[model samples]
Target: RKARALLVASLLLHDFHLRFEQVRRAEVLALLRALGVPRVHEDFIFIIINFSCFEISFHPQSWVVTSLVIVI
Candidate 1:
């Protein structure tokens, strides 16, 4: 059980990092949209949302800090 838990935690952290990257990219596109830039690809938006949820589920606190730092 302990080993399983550790494995799960590691997977979660890996997923969180991937999602964090996606969200960061999406936010940048969003900023561009706000600035009258052409919209980004739909696939990009979909990937961002999907990865972001994975990150949120895996590590909410880390996601918050990481996302904020990336955004800024």
Candidate 2:
């Protein structure tokens, strides 16, 4: 039951992160456009945002799982 609760919490957090990312992406794009940044630069910024989101979502989980494996 604890595990199930954790799973549910994790799913909720993941969904929140995705929604936050979408809003953040929109805000950043708007800011860039307002500043008259070029299309190529906009694409680069988008890539960076994606990488940041990936790291935010997965890197800590990987570390925790690794530590658990080592402890076991």
User: Which is the leading candidate under lDDT?
Assistant: 1
Question: How far out, in Å, is residue 57 in model 1?
Answer: 9.7
Cα-based TM-score, every candidate: 0.27, 0.29
Q: Rate the local accuracy (lDDT) of all candidates.
A: 0.40, 0.35
Q: How far does residue 51 in candidate 2 sit from its true spot (Å)? A: 3.2
Per-residue lDDT value at 5 in model 2? 12
> Any runs in candidate 2 off by more than 4 Å, and if so which?
1-23, 40-43, 52-72
- Model 1 misplaced regions, further than 4 Å: 1-32, 36-38, 53-72
Candidate 2 residue pairs in backbone clash: none
